[model samples]
Structures are given as structure tokens and as C-alpha cells.
Target: MAATKKARQPAELEMIGGKSKRQRIWEVIRAQRDGLTCYALSRRSGVDDCTTKTYMQALERGGFIEQSNETVRIGDEKQYRLIKDNGLEAPRLTKDGQPVTQGRSQEQMWRTMRILGSDFNYQELAGLASTSEVTVSPAAARDYLKHLAHAGYVTVVAKGKGRGAGGVPNRYRFNLGRYTGPRPPMVQRTKSIYDPNVGKVVWQEEVSDDDL
Candidate 1:
């Protein structure tokens, strides 16, 4: 056991600034969605108990993971599933028998919101979605928050500062405990050009604009 501990130390030392540690601990908790105690998390992540506890607490505070008296789980304590949508190259079955990849951006976001098990701050939402901070721009985030407020899926615990006071700080909380709605539509756009002199129009189809 001592030899094994020694061998894992180098790997543990590799997790500086706690980023890798967060990801590693998250992965371990994800692997066992049924939930794992801190000891179990330490064993699986190959991280020390203290490091695991510290990182786990941070994740919990960020709404990335959850902790009870002893057991640790992904995302919320009651939901026990991470509400995130990134790195989904394909579909897989979740513990609840739902397809991990539900398709469509709104569905993805909805699934993510549910997995998050509660409302989240914009930064938390973006990080869990593996999206850029700007990807969930203030406008888009506001739209979702408004919808959530109306649908009872969530409530605005605090109104957003409106991106004026340094930035928006809209905080939210989940009330529905789940997401259910029709998938959002996907639209494709094309541009057209016209020749005024000839009174003719070009559909701009079947040719790459770069070619012109």
C-alpha cells in the first residue's frame, strides 16, 4: 500500500492550482453516479483526502458538485447528476434511462439546466456547458431566465444587475427540478443578390460565395 501511495504522489503533485484536481474529482463522481463518499472519491481520484475535500467543497459552492453529511455526488444533492452538456460527440444513456444527447441547442441547455438540478449563475452555467463566457451572452442568459421565471422551472432569486454594474449578476434557483418542453427549432439562413439593371435575381445557391 505504501508503494502504491508513493507511485500516486507524483500524479497527485501534477494537479497544481487545483484545476486538474477539480476535473479529476468530477470525473470520479461522474463515474459513480450512485454517489461516493469522500474516502471513495479520494481512492478513485488518487488525490489526498484533504485535497479532495477542498476541491469538492469548491465544486459544491460552484454548483458543479454536491455534498451531504458524508456522501458526495455530482451537481445537486437531491438530483445526483451533473447538469452539464459538453464533450457530447454522441449519445449515451444516463442513469435515469434518458439519452445524454437529446439534440438541439435548447434541449442541450435544458438538459444541462436539469442536470445542474438548481438554477445557476451565468459563470456556473457557462462552465458546466463547456461554453465560452460570451457564448451565453447576457442577452441569451436573460432570455432563459425570463422563460424560467414564467414557466416555474426556476425563479430569479436575484435580478441581474443588467451588465451595467460591472456586469450582470443574475442568480437563479431551480423549482421544477426537471425540464420538459418541445425542442427548439433549428433555422438555416441564406442570402440573395439581385441585378437591378437586368431586373433579375440570383438565389446564391449551389455555389460557394468564396468562389465569387
Candidate 2:
């Protein structure tokens, strides 16, 4: 009788400290010398396209990875590589011991507030901030400004009447003197591309230490 062929087994995914699958995907990308395309990363991690994209976006926002300016021609997938080889994850606190904002949205708001140079209500602030090339809703802008005020990065320069017809909103001013928060990361814009998959123009930037 002919020898029966042995069934092939799938490679077992190694678990590090029982981390979630998303964390494992990050590890796989970190282990690679060259960056991996989203599709390739999904295949290696056994993750679906949507989940992989979500995790990648989270990592990118958290400043853990460097993304490529160009996407793969075949799949139109962006490539990403670990920013640091030493497994330096995003810090929850800044060097001054202040809590780090969860995402780039807050940072953009802070930058816009600094540019405003005077006390302004949330609506005016939001409208001016929106022109800074980052999408921020007026509601989100108001909430984040409140968060910053609570954190001592901003001051409630003036108060308004209760919510009523023709009621003026409280105006706020950026508190440059009291802020000990971390400086924004330096971003260097590179070439741009029009991703057909997303059907939008996208630009990539190299992030580095602001002091550098």
C-alpha cells in the first residue's frame, strides 16, 4: 500500500504574556526588518483585513510605527514598520508626569489653540481649528478644550450664561505658562499619493523627536 501523506498543521501563534491577537500582530510586524504590507501582515497574523487595518491605525496614532508614503500597487495596501527596535511602546504619561492625550486629535487642538493667540468661544475656536488640515468636530473640539482646561493646559478665561436663547459660550485661552505637557512630535511630510482603495488623497510623514 502506498504510504499515506501526513496532514499539514498550521503554525502555532506564540503568545507573549497572554497578549491579545492585535498585540501579537504588532509583534510580528516588529520582528520584520523591512516593513510589511497590510495584506501580508494580515496573512501572517491570521487577522481579517478590517481588524488588521484597525489595529494598524491604532498603532500609527499611538506613534508606534512608521508608515510608508506609497502603497503596494497590487493591493493598494500601506506598509508599516516598527519605529523602534527596543519595543518602546507609547507612553501613557509625558516626561513632566502629565497624562498623555489619547490621540492626535487633542494635540491638533492644542496647536490650533496656541495659534489663536486670544480667548475664543468653542464655536469660533472649532471653526478656526478646522482650517488647520485636521478634521475636528465642534463638539469634540469643545470637549477636548475642557479636558485641557481641567489638565491646566488651558484656562477658562470667561464664563457665559446658562444654555438659553442667544446665550454666549464660555471663552477659553491657551495657558502657555502653566503647561508642562510633552511637545508635539515632529512630522516631516513626504510624497503624497491617491489611494484608489480609499478613494482619497493621502500624505505620509516621518515622525521624529521635536527636539531633533
lDDT of 2 by residue, 81-199 (tens): 77745452323433333435555555666667777778888888767766444566778777666655544567888997877568878898887774433333211122222222222
Query: What digit string (tens of lDDT, one per residue) describes model 1 on residues 78-99?
Result: 3234444233121233433344
**Alpha-carbon RMSD, each predicted model:** 19.6, 18.4
10 residues in a row with least lDDT, candidate 2: 185-194
**Clash numbers, per candidate:** 3, 0
- TM-scores for every predicted model: 0.31, 0.40
Query: How displaced is residue 200 in candidate 1, in Å?
Result: 43
Candidate 2 stretches with Cα past 4 Å from truth are 1-104, 181-212
For residue 42, model 1's alpha carbon misses the true position, in angstroms, by 56
Output the number of the TM-score-best candidate. Answer: 2
